[model samples]
Target chain A: MNWKRYERASDLNGALTLLDRAEGTGRVIAGGTDLVLQLGQRQKSAELLVDVTGIDELRGLCASGAWIRIGAAVTHREAAASGLLREEAAVLAEGCGMVGSPQIRNIATLMGNVITAQPAADAAVPLTALGAELRVVSAAGERWVPLEEAYRGVGESAIDATREVATEIRFRRPGAGAKTRFFRLARRKALALPVLNGAVCLWRDGDAGRIREARIALGPVAARPFRARQAEACLTSDRITAALLEEAARLAAGEATPRTSLIRGSEEYRRAMIRLYLTRTLWEMLDIG
Target chain B: MDHGVKIRMKVNGQWREAETTPDRLLIDLLREEFGFTGTKKGCGEGECGACTVILNGRPLLACLIPAAKAEGADILTVEGLTPEQGLHPIQQAFQDEGAVQCGYCTPGMVMTAKALIDENPSPTEAEIKRAISGNICRCTGYTKIVAAIVRGAALLRGEAATTPAGVDRERVPQLPPVGPG
Candidate 1:
């Protein structure tokens, strides 16, 4: 790659100005794990590299009222190490930890992963399950979108390229008795991208032990990370049982829309593994493990 | 139209100033400009662990970091493991357990292991596996490497000035000299 001008933005306003004045010739880089690869491959262009790692406002995780807010530039490693995130949004933390190896996780940001918009992205599944919302800012103004609605197409998002940048991700705090689990089946154990994955979040209702609500999200089974609404509906207001779990698993597998890849698995095989994970996750969540 | 940037970074415990293209990768800067060849480059795409190094106490892929953005950051490479007296305990353990074969991946492995020990002094086998999961050693099969790290942890704990130290560096295995005497 050829040399390019580099500008380090110390604050959000400064970054906005740089973005505005670059005449659509600049690209914002946070952590640079993904962008560097894209640049090396000549997959993207940016005459002016706006380094955003210096902005302190985009760097922490906190809870406000009933919602947990995470800065866009916060790294996967940071999220994995957070006590508050692990306590409030266990599934999201676990999913972030599984995104890449420790080194990649140390630098790759949560917002960067979402903005990449790959259907098989590990973090998006959990965020979809949590009903996460995003806060996007621009040189012009700001806007908020429910995380699920942010996906306008495959490899495209609702954020405008000319002015907007992801700023925050917010989601409701899970209740005290709630439990979250993330499951995936890939060719190898570590560092390999997910071919298929799922996240499950369930909360119990009082001592009756009935499932008050369940959110099940699957990745690589659709154009975007999708909720298994049929599976969740089967669990609602019902006592945890093996037959119900099996029915839900079958429904989830039937709901998926996996595409054939050049790798080891076929579309049929991917759907089967999705069924296996869904059943096992439900059983484990009910403490039948 | 672009120009090289003059960025100053603290690499291997020393401040270094270099004029690099804006797109220069930190991995190349470490090996080429700083002459710290201990941080290896493998799968420049960051999928491989050969480029692992410690930046500000956190382990990261050097290949994934832009040279210009690393300004004023503390970077520790495998060359920093040994000063003047002797080899680091982790290096010693790898030698005694025969964890190194081709040697191309040793520097990154050692640095990754160092970060793990810094965080968890007495890590279990599972913890050790998790710590080095980012590092791929296709040659040693990871058995000897994991054992070496466990032994190394004990050695590091012993070297501490505290009375209840966890590692004893004196008893660690001895390895050959590392990174240009």
Candidate 2:
């Protein structure tokens, strides 16, 4: 609730210039659902707010041959309603929908969710599962960073907010006959942040139905959202069965090192849920449920 | 420091400009500056849905929105939903189905319900549950509220609301024509 001068940037270039000049003094505001709330709680402060909601290039989803591009400033509601996202990355859409509530989804941006780097960020798990990349724009130029490399801390991101404005998030769409599912173990039904959310994506490879790739992303368990590579490796063979899924779940459970927070989830409960959700999600994805 | 910033917001249907602090919450502006007090504030945090309003045709928690950020946005509160002519269908349905108990959560519930019906004209019980899941009601276990939304959808469909003798049946807008009736 501290005093700050707010200015609406005309375009992405304007925003980049403002960010470059102000260093840490200016913060980009899009949607403002999270940033405004954080400001009110005194979690973040700035001398100037560069509102970028009106920036055209920073909104909407675009699809190419294999890559799907999601604008950083696209609202969660837009992401939830995107048919391309639903077809290509349904988990991302469903996860975005589950954040906060319908109201928060209307104004909260995907970039904001990614930048917050909260371990419990619902959309982060799916992004990690899809191998999404962060496209950042600064006064100097543009660069791409993998989603996993973007996080540095629980609530901190490696992308310098002072110098960069996240412009796009891109990921490869799963090929033919691929199946993906997003599931979360939240305390309550709506508006509540995830206690421990996860995403599982598997693709078919030839006649054997290989798990071409599997991503086991866990949230609220570490400094940043992470994919359980050991678990993913366990299921990346031609043969995928209930036993293999159980093993993957067991491995995923071991990867998480959850800490106790005001939110009433313990390390024990989260680990259990990770294993439970992994098997359940695997079953649900394979239509063996 | 003169910390207040100038912002323009579309309250109901009118565009009004006001100078407010960068941190001024939306609930305070609705009640104090705009004088439309129908939107209540229960938990200052986003947990409670008492201060729900329609932002860009979608329901959102107004209490969590900063007044400065709502610039040039369309906001529809409970007061905005009702017309000078009469009550909106959601309001009538709440009255008809006896959904209001303490009448505190009604405004937020109405806004949330409006969003649900607007998006999905005939939402299933599960969808309705998901839509209002953010709204917490200490009284009225939400059975009647859900029923009221169903009844309101029927009313909007122009399917004869079956009102009592004294009610006017003409105020509610009719649903758009669809497949052969």
Candidate 3:
């Protein structure tokens, strides 16, 4: 609890002005699920906390044409309950639904999950697969940073929270031919961190029955959310087949770099599970037995 | 800069005000400042739901929320459950089902159940389990807690209460009346 001042920002400009006034010692606090705990544990320090939850511009989930925008204050519970996300971005909804318990979900925002930048963050893994972009606002101006580029390393975010506010996360809605799936392997069903989590967004050609485009995102297997580009390349423009799926799974398993840890288990096990989970996710997406 | 900030919020249907530090947790403000001790502090972190409270119609971990965040928000704690005369239906259901053992997790469990039942009047067994998943009960093993929630739902729906197979309805112990602390 190193905080010396806390101010609630009623709008985006107010937030930026507060941050600019604090210089580099201020940090944005939304949901506070991670930041509060980190501050309590003395893992992080902040001289001022700019509360962004009060800002009206940073609220709700909405759709505009092909893009869906989720404001930074949108909690996991709200996202999970959203009819739009469930129908169009089912993988993101599923990933968010698996985060923590009901209490945690009710207040833990999706942007907070992304900003915390945990490698295996449930929400971030699916957002990565969905190719979401972050709208970051600072005193200079606003910029959209691709979700992949937003991560600096494990537990590190390229967006400086002290000087910037991640306003929203936006991604194009999955088209009619597209389907997505997310799978998480954890110690327990609730209130447990993921040992390994994965998400896949795939589009199939209607007439040709070929894979149109695919994005495979897996986590706790690399420094940040790891995209299996090689694995995705094997499926793109290829006709659907069990053999091809297996080959892609093998490539994905080879691409992962999971570390052996006390909680998540050995690297050998996670690598094997990656192959199995990726295969199952693709199979479920394609309705393959 | 470390001086206390004045914050006003509605707690348990009454408006209350408190001056708190920037880093003071909501749980501390409720228990220490306002004397709403029913909200227990279990893990102090968000891992345990012993400090669960309803904020703006959502059940959230009070320990994780800063006191300043509760400004102008509505909060409901376990102490707010009872009515004018007797125990709340949920509390009565817990008593009938013997849901209280160590009683440490009861406040959180009850608050979580209240939020769930308020949203979904007829929650299934799985829903009840999921609703109270964050609340850790070491004594009851959650079997009675789940049963109590189901029974509480039934009672809330104005249905007649049926006695559990083994428990004697006449011998059920009475809970002390709850009021503003």
Measured by DockQ, the strongest candidate is: 3
Question: What lDDT does candidate 2 reach at residue B163?
Answer: 44
* TM-score per model (chain B): 0.85, 0.86, 0.90
Task: Name the lDDT value of residue B126 in candidate 1.
Answer: 96
lDDT of each: 0.83, 0.82, 0.90
Which pairs clash in the backbone of model 3?
Answer: none
Model 3: TM-score for chain B: 0.90
Candidate DockQ values, in order, are 0.62, 0.44, 0.68
lDDT of 3 by residue, A222-276 (tens): 9888999999999895568888888999999998899899889998999999999
Give the best candidate by lDDT: 3
For candidate 2, write residues B42-77 as lDDT tens digits.
Answer: 987777788999988888888877677677889999
Candidate 2 lDDT, tens digit per residue, A1-289? 4636666787998888887778788887777767776777788777778877778887768797789988877988889889988987888898998887777777788888899888888888789888899998888888999999999888888887766888889998786666778888777777677887888777777545677777778787888887899999998887777898899999989987886667846778778888998888887777553
What share of the reference contacts is kept in model 2? 0.65
Candidate 3 on B1-181: residue-level lDDT in tens? 3487888999999999987777888999999999999999999888889999999998999999988888899999987887888999999899888899989899999999999999999999999988998999888788888989899999999986665623577777889999899
Q: Could you tell me how far off, in angstroms, the CA of residue A200 lies in candidate 3 after the best superposition? A: 0.7
lDDT of 2 at B125: 78
Name the runs in model 3 displaced over 4 angstroms: B162-166, B169-181
